[model samples]
Target: MKMVDTMCNMHLHNYKDILEIRRNTSDFMWCSRELNLTKSYRQYHDLTDPYKFQYDVFRSTDIQRLIEEVSKCNNCSNEEVSKHVVEILKEIGHTRQMAVFRCFGLCFIKVLKEVISCVFVNEAQILKLKSEMGGNPVIFVPSHRSYADFLLMSYITFHYNIEIPCIAAGMDFQSMRVIGKILRDCSAFFMRRSFVDDQLYRSVFKKYVQHLVTYGDAPIEFFIEGTRSRSAKALVPKFGLLNMLVEPFFNGDVPDIYFVPVSFSYECVLEESLFAYEMLGIPKPKESTSGLIKALKIMDEKYGNVHATFSEPISFRKYLTQTLSATLDFTKRDSVEESGHCFHLAYQIVDCQQKNMVLNTFNILAMVLTNHLMVNSLEPLLIDHVSKDVVWLSAVLKTQGAVVQPISHGTAVSVLMESIKVHQSLIRVSASGTISLVKLNNDKCKTLDPQTLRGHKLSTDMMNLAVPMLTLQLYVNPCLHFLINSAIITVIMQQVGANSHINKNSLFMKFVFVRELFAHEFVFYRPVETQEFEDALTKLELLSIIESEPLRLGNHQKLQALFCNLLYPFFSGYLSVCRFLLTADNLEWEERQFLKSAQERIEEELISGWLLQPYCLSLDMISSCIAALTSMIVLSKIRRGSQVHYKVDKDRLIPVISHLESLFYLPQKYQTRDQDSLEDTESIQVISSSEPLQRLVSKL
Candidate 1:
């Protein structure tokens, strides 16, 4: 674990040959990510799907029989579900390699704090957090970046000698061959897609999650956004699992609920190269057997410790109050609270890591410089850069006593920064060290307020297309747009004594930037012919883009993120005018071009002319919607280069607000059947005969 200035009798730049010597001398050692396990994995019975976790012990066994015999049940037997899982796991052969259940069950049984310290860079931070929490179920909900989350969580819980809770995964991969067995073993159950007509499945999932939380058997894990975002920036939370995660808390069995928002960080992502290809208008590929192989080799034994830090928990009362407020404002509770918690926690822990962990000056320089290098607005950032940015940053953070270790010199800084610049999400790194941002979050990062001022300005194209930069990414804006504009368009049309049928069929189109002000000339999303779709998608697959069809409402499941990108601008433009500005007439031609693209390519979508669509809802109502959106960003002082962008003056903006007041402001249309018992059930008692569950309570 110690660093040395020289290699064993080696000259400079002999690292490659040294690697060869190590490979030849030590069988356990590996370099260039090669595990030399192709032979073992090729063993016909060694079926392993890296995309999903599949556990053998859970499959081909009577886990349900054991549970039922011990606990008893009134509903349909789990025998059938167990059978499905076993069958799938055996077929895919992926069940044997996963460590999820082993990690969870073992941690629950052993409760060793050493396991945690051994695998994390920020162990002390967590220890302090644990002492503060003093025992409650702390939910670790993070942005879903990869399947690695399973390992990261498992390792954290294992190291701390605590039991991490079961997670809820989609039926698609979680229930698929081999992967399903691993998930079930890890206490993960299948969650049905929202569009599925099966209410029974959803109910079962809700009840299962509730059982886990109410009994305090394990802490629960969930992804706020539901799925991994295509772009790297976090996406808004999808409510599919939120209601269930909180169900136990609402029932009152637990006195308090503490939500531990965790931020998962990695020096190098397993899926980076794969995701880069996806930004070039290619269809993304699914995690196939080969991809799984790569993932397993990389994961089964990566030397670097994964970092998972827990924030202070919140009581159930606070969560419930915040939840209600969020639902009312059409804002997410986790969004308001967790974002702050994670961001602050990440910076603090990362700062701690620099000083306490073995991070040298190289890492510090690389981390900051690479980040600065990615900034599109160089003038502003460079002014910060040439002034010895990281040095100043370390000094500023130190003024508040943040633990940022100093670097050796500017040389170490430049090398590390160059290395980081070589590795950026969605951004292409050229041989010459020139860089361009790529859209890594895919459609998930599509924001409503993105380039609001830029509109169709070609120079701001990167902001419009890729995951938003810290300076450019607007997390709260897209939800605001969707809530205020798309959903309300129909409601407003119905209220104003307009066409009722028109309202039902309309939905908004997602936007894409064809020509933008800031986009590099080398970066672009090209339209592919039908024959090229498969190939392009293959390349996208190689790029590791997370592309899930969020809403497959069409008779034909032909929706693409690109298509969404193409259509959203018009709808956003329309909504802006209605909600923020009086009109779009004052905006220049660049602002109008965004609408022009939507109009010209409108027919590309299957729902182009269909009634009840977000775009074509009226007067061709879609145009009016775009007009409203355009005005919001365009006419607002934000776009006018005023001292404060989007500054709302009550009297001046009230009229702008009044024009679109009805957006997302609707009466409760359907009452939830399970609203009465939002917390733990009264009938349940939380009892632990195990060490892990006992630890979870003590820590929470």
Candidate 2:
């Protein structure tokens, strides 16, 4: 990728830098004084005031009227309603004291600096957004990737002189004792994970959020995804909080709300281990103050650099005006209709978040390195291959409209080396100077079935590799979404061959099909416009990756190989799941049970060296693939006694599996046709069929 000049020079700050900056700047006292001087602020200056205000809003005459109207059928009393209001407030409210906010902000900056090297990218966009903030309530919707995400947004705004936002935080942190209280004081409002059945809490929380947007001067911040993404890519958005935040704009309480989508890319995530466990179907540990303290013990380790890119602000008023051409009259709508409208708006916001995500050097490097590792080709040609792939990826990202760091051919190795050092524990260099992943030596690996240990007889070595590869997959995950369309087209071209009459509609259908198949493996936002496939094909032709006239194609054998390599894991995992479903005696199985069995089966495949696609070991992706299959009618779902069970349809199942299996075979020029047999092939095979698959078997 050609490096372009960024608005601000990248700022790299060490842990001690925070202390030095704190000592040099005495603005804390001034900030505290400013906090004390304002009357409205004073009224809510105590740590408990915001919570009380939320209760007041809930108990307001309007809310009481609505509650009475909604609950009259049940003969609920005013006292009972009042009691419910208190419970709702306790669950959803938070207090913000300027003094406490300032203190925590300082400490947060210090702790963040100590733990990770933070880099703020696209500052020019942030400056522009900041200048445009005053007329409307600004909402900062950053992609959530790790626990550190909570602090990064606040730190960036404070560093740039913007007011710290009133953040919406999950109730998971509410139990963190002193930390929880401090977070509340620092402008974080705790929210229940789900309020589906709690109408009272939902109503109260909605009003509280609306109050903030209408009155609060500071910007409002919350993750569009709702929670930290376990897979490290943007999750399908949870619309509840987003709907609540945007309601004020539609209600005409606020003239407009500007949403700033921020994307955070990490060289190494603080919650990598936890996320890995969660992906393996292991339940995450509950959040607690003691756990937080224990986690702090490992703060001294290096976490490399974190890049936060702020995309251009999106106006909610303008968006709604465009989406809903008619004047909106929220007053005329029922609760259900209003919710449906809000969900539609939430989807638009999610799209903005997805587009705003910038792929940086760290993630790109991880992807390139991980692909090489998966193929066992990193040893002899590690530096050379990584360098070439990085350059290729840079150009590809640039073409895809991502803001990649300027990487010269000379510096690519150094950049990758830095990444290796940052994730040193997961990757290692042997005495022979060959690179390999650290093997799992834990009790967890020991208990795994021997059939799952493919190449290694011992469980420890198997796990060491499996665990690190899974973590590496997290870093690689985000990049896949960007490359999916191109990958689909490239793979199809290789299958259909050059000089063949390729039907555009058929190709588009195939693109959609492959995209859906890997939906769980990669989280991608489906574009509203149908032109994405056409656009990708057009670009590929322009780049000579494919030819339009006579439908000839370029020799993208190397490129096609890389794309196949990236997809191998998902295909293998899906194959394993399908195989398991085929053999299992139970025609119908609960979702959780099926997922557990699929994971165990994949692990066994990995251990027995039967599955060469390391990335396929993820239980999250397996579960998602199963859901996708059900949607495709390859699997039928039956709800029995409150539990959903799935039964595979043999007819639908065969075609879908065949299509996925075909993706593993590259064009002939890209492989050796004489490869011993299908059994000897590692991850993918060379297609030798006479149909479309045989078209490209000839030498380049």
Candidate 3:
């Protein structure tokens, strides 16, 4: 393996060094000869380091100050513009290598000669698109699906004889040790996750993009949901990059910057089926080298082929996503927060739960096909059963005459069973041998807690649920229900104790406070009614975040672990900060799943609560519970603006009061019910109590 790799790598260096050099350049531009002038360079060094060559070539030139010099130009001096141009060129170069590798695997370079000799200009129109790529270094924004997107696009650019374009990828890729080091040496730039929040980093990265945009060949590019869409659709556009593009337009710094929407259709994505299964909560370990070899062997035993289509471009930056909001017929008001993430163009590829794959004919078909099978009593069906909603998917495959083996109900079921055995998803014995797709949390996620500032490693089962609705094609409706159920945690919280006397009117004020949020976060959608969503108060009461619970559960109960994991979503913005009424045996697996998926929704709601003050009454019992809910000891402290020290009880509550006068309760007409701690204990056995305050805590 090492010998083959070394020989292949050496071969890769010889054929593509100049082009490779261009890819590695930060600001330098070169004629083919300047790039191809490696005879002396290679011989002088007696070695090949893509990075060393890149830095040496560029540093040897005057490109370091290229941007500074360009910025001095009144005719064309936008730092942002220049950076994008340079970045695009490099992105193109790196993408080419990746593209070849995808097709030829580890032997890409070894097979390159044959492929180039045989494969003619695949698409002439694609080859001559630069003239049409108008302004702002035209960037092709396509929905993300598999990691193979980078390669497919690069191949198209190189085949078309177009100039290599630089690509912008996340820093995570650059962190892959030697591979990352080599990629950085190529044109791929390092972008930190924090760059999304910290504008300074964004500015620097944006400036780099602008520079690249002005320097390279049509700077071929696509931002995969800004990062990589995990769900099978174009996720929300990270307007941050879009905003940078818009800067030139708004300032008249450059001519029109065109944004062409490219629709990519894949018959079989290298990562499609597995990635889909994974994101759908399937527990398959990543295909290791040996596993990949095994899969390849299987592919050879069957048939392997791929077909892709590049849709006509959609341009009109003036009518970008923000300008054209999609109005789905169904309303998921509870998932307004997740909806925001959906709208942002940038994405992060974590576990299947965190990322969304790009949507295409295959995924759409997969979903329709899976649902048809799952609904038909878990009997997998043929593509013949594909639904009209996802029919375009079939068309995409049929047009290319796909080589995939026909899947009958029996065969499909068999394969699905095999997938489950490998842990791509799970099969539960509940409901007489029901299959539920689930991904177990790995060690990295199992030990985390978003609540503990230092313990961000998520508990496994809970993390499993927080992942987005990647299998949207299969359980779109069920997913919606699950989200709706999870969303209720905060939505109906203000009214948890129906008979409680915490002023009803004021209670309404402490809810939803909906704002920009993703739909898949906290809003779990289930196909049917679920108690986890239905029993909001019971969960909250148990969480001890609400002072209503008489006795908190022993931390070791299965319920406590479940609640902690599920509630992480609530705290982390899946559900808005609210209380769940937790109690003994309050939820089953169905309920737990609903609770787990509510993180994004809860987080968004928490934001709204912060901005809108969802905790309407200063005396909200839940807030007090939140103060004392953790295993940490509850402490007495002075209110932000008050003088007297307020003490919190074991349920983690501090008495909330309103000053009616300079020295009296604020609501002078309000009556006070002075009851002892023991007096309110009776409310536990019954669902409700008569006292106004007690009722509010118990039933109201």
Candidate 4:
């Protein structure tokens, strides 16, 4: 729980302090000095000649098998297959040179001092993991946030004096000239992004990874999310790489494997700007040496602290045993069944990573500040107001069993001010000591209202908001999974009053309904578990927000306000998208066509002052909402030749939009009386109209 300062002013001399903290803390146990490498690993690397080891054992059998498989197709000669195998080996294989690793380790530490303020590790869990590593292959499955993730894993291991892992990097990096070679020298192996039709390459790559797990002694490291999370939330796990890494244990080639779910939290993501553009449907630039050289200029700027936390090791043998017990004859299962098992395992790892994520001071502050902007408009938020909200949020998170960063209420404002300063474009402070959102540049702004010259394009506002809010959203995204249950309960309680005799079955059904509505808007690991729903109910009862006997609820005014703030972005975004969809000229349209049309209409609405929060214009989230509508039969899918089209059912969608709008719109009384009223109060107007459906249809 203590912070480690690795600043350069200290001469990079914090090792003694780290060691002392480890000694005092019961959670961390240092590894034995004599056991740097396992006996088998030592024996393998101790050969007098490097070529002898390579000739006898470096994926020879797998390469032969791949060559034979390729030769069977008669697609190429034996010599060609052999040459392909050689190229694949060079691409996927790692050279574990201790001297090279040490050199890179020192260089990484020095470079990190310039780029980041500090690097924090969860020492106790890491030490425990190291202690348990000798019996099985150890795998580190970290959430991929940046290119920095790959180096961070190796850096931490080397810092701890443990054997460095062989990292699985994308083939994009392998093409980066000197950087690629240096990465390989530092024990990184590359894999193609997709391997659908290339069976020869697939076999070679798969066998290369298997050889590492089964025979190589170093721990294996890979991203379970498969790639960086573009939206900064945990993505549904990608099973391709996880399946290959775990296959050794399933095939009995290795006794067992231990997976350590690692979570990383950064104060400032290096690629935040690029990720924002990608979210707007722009293609990400490919990795290149020139790009690397250009990026080096930013090295002079400071990116804040990063925290890496490791969770308890998950035993693969035990998990498989438990999972297969019901099958009765797992060994007789087909490839499909095996794939299913791998998918289940992938989900389990994702869940583990989610739970391991530590909500730091920066993310919590971002959540409070973002919500403030959403409810209060772009006006300057009082410093005291932001600080008060942060305290409230931190308390709420702690009660829900989340790991909140330890910051006193008095210090919360300072922390928030620091975070805002890091991303200067997000917020601007006035001379009067109030904070306001920085508007987008005039060149980037598009006129939504041609007549008045006041209309702004949705993309313009989105781009402007993306500068500050997108990065803020990244910090807030991790906590959404934790807050969703409470959010649902609060929304339900508000809808169904304390005087009503609510049916438990009906209540749970409604909860599920709301959960599915925003499934795409939020990163839920899976469907809401029954136990979680029950727990939420119990929590409500304890807080007197609801009663169990008659299933009644309480007023809980403060709780309602808190929940409303938390869910505003998602609920508002969904409602806005649905409203835009209803304006389409044709009901039946292909998905891509629908999205393009929706984007245009949304921008038009933004110009017309129909949408309030520009950050809500997420294309992916809009698509997810459409899919959810499809699932609920509010939108029907129609097949037009080879294309899939959607037909919106206005009859069903009207009530859905009304209910969500009610949840999203904040009451005028909720705001401080002194604050100016928002000009774009169109949402309130829509909800208050007696014939809402008729009004919406006429406007369209």
Cα deviation at 127, candidate 2, in Å, is 2.4
The residue-by-residue lDDT of candidate 1 on 1-700, one tens digit each, is 0111110121112111111232235222211122222110012232243233334334213444443543344444567555654554333222223345554434332222221112333455455545544345566665465566765675455434454446666666653555566566555645555735643344334444554455433566777657764333344345555556564544554555566556554434445443322322223556454555555443332222233434334444554345323343213445545533333322222222222212222233332323332211222223223224345323423332223334433453354354344344323444644434344333422433333422221222222322222212111111221122222222332233211222222212111111111011111122212222333333222222212133112211111111222233333334333332333332233333434333323322212211111222111223333333334433343454323333223444454354434332211111112212212111211122121211211111
Candidate 4, residue 621: CA error in Å?
A: 1.9
Backbone clash numbers for all candidates listed: 83, 12, 130, 2
Candidate 1: residue 86 lDDT (0-100): 54
Task: List candidate 1 segments past 4 Å from native.
Answer: 1-100, 103-121, 128-136, 195-197, 276-281, 294-306, 318-387, 393-418, 421-700
**Which one wins on TM-score?**
2
- For candidate 3, the per-residue lDDT at 403 reads 21
Q: After superposition, how far is residue 162 of candidate 2 from its true place, in Å?
A: 2.9
The digit string of per-residue lDDT tens for model 3 on 1-700 reads 0000000111111222112332345321222222211010012222233333333324422354554554565355556745653553343223234333233422432232222212221132343345455334556554455565665555545434454445566665654655554454434555555555543335445654554443333353646356443333333345455545434433344444444344343333344344433433334544344454555432322112222333333333333333234442113433432443223222211111111112223343334333322122224332223222233322322222222223333344443333234323322222334434443444545443444321122334333333322332322221222123223333333223333333323332332222112222322222112323224444445433233333222222222222222222223221122222221132221222323333233323323322111111111112322333221233344444423332333243121111101111000010113211111211111111122221111110
| Candidate 3 total steric clashes | 130
Ranking by lDDT: 4, 2, 1, 3
Q: Supply candidate 4's per-residue lDDT for 568.
A: 61
Which is better, 1 or 4, measured by lDDT?
Answer: 4
Model 2 C-alpha lDDT per residue in residues 1-115, reported as the tens digit of each score = 1111122222222112222344456645523444312111112233246756775677677678867866685697767877777777766666767677777765665566576
Listing every candidate in turn, what is its Cα RMSD in Å to the true structure after a full C-alpha superposition? 23.3, 7.3, 19.6, 8.2
**Model 1: which ten-residue window has the lowest total lDDT?**
1-10
